[model samples]
Target: MNKASRSTVYDGEVTWQRIADEVGLSRQGAKHVYNKAILKLQKNEQLKQYWVDLIIEGRATKCD
Candidate 1:
């Protein structure tokens, strides 16, 4: 699934461990994917808006 979709699935409250379990990835792998997805969104202005909207709407939240 796409990063945004995956992020939505857990209501944005997913930890790396949770992502690892759900996606069958290692913790580090999940972290890498999350970071990469954020970077990609940041680099593109249009996508950045979507990312910001998601954050503002509480569609995505940082994992503790």
Candidate 2:
């Protein structure tokens, strides 16, 4: 769900509804989940690398 949400929303593409559908959720539900996750990652020093890793992996996948 994060991957789907990030790929679309991060790229300025619409259709979070589609991602929510794929994950059996509403658009707001998906956004809420993602928002919480992002906030948590930003707040945590130890887990910050995980956020960076996610971004790197995402970019890598897009490049491929």
Candidate 3:
């Protein structure tokens, strides 16, 4: 979860290859873990509000 969270914190600029190497998983496996973490986060009400606040305050940024 730490590795996945760090990658997401960087706006996904970190590649799956790097995360996979660090976690001793294949690229696909790393992606799977990251996806699962995201699915869990999506269910967190506090996190949802945090994102909504960021968006409302114009502090949210996404990669093009």
Candidate 4:
């Protein structure tokens, strides 16, 4: 959820609809991705930076 969380953290907004539109995903799909990220962050404490970098890269690549 790096991109989605970036919306809230950096832009002070959490527009899932706009994110979905920009990345060509359904709104629910975007939310699903974000939720999965959340679970990962909570459950996988080790290698946090690795997962974070991966998430940011995914966002940079437009969720590809």
Per-candidate TM vs. native?
A: 0.62, 0.61, 0.52, 0.54
Instruction: Give candidates' CA RMSD values in order.
Output: 7.0, 5.6, 6.4, 9.4
Instruction: Give the alpha carbon lDDT tens digit for every residue of 1-64 in model 4.
Output: 4476556533347589977976689999999998998788778777577787987996887745
Clashes of 4: 0
Q: Flag regions of model 2 displaced more than 4 Å.
A: 1-14, 58-64
lDDT of 4: 0.77
- lDDT of candidate 3 at residue 13, scale 0 to 100: 61
Instruction: Rank the candidate models, highest lDDT first.
Output: 2, 1, 4, 3
Worst-scoring 10-residue span by lDDT in model 3: 3-12
Best candidate according to lDDT: 2
**CA shift of 20, model 4, Å:** 0.3
lDDT of 3 by residue, 9-62 (tens): 444368889779777899999999988877776999887788678776754334
Query: Which residue window of length 10 is worst by lDDT in model 1?
Result: 4-13
lDDT of 1 by residue, 1-64 (tens): 4565565644436678877877788999999999999899989999999878987776344543
Query: Which ranges of candidate 1 are over 4 A from the true structure?
Result: 1-12, 59-64
- So what's the TM-score on candidate 2? 0.61
- What would the TM-score be for candidate 3 when compared with the true structure? 0.52
Cα error of candidate 3 at position 46, Å: 3.8
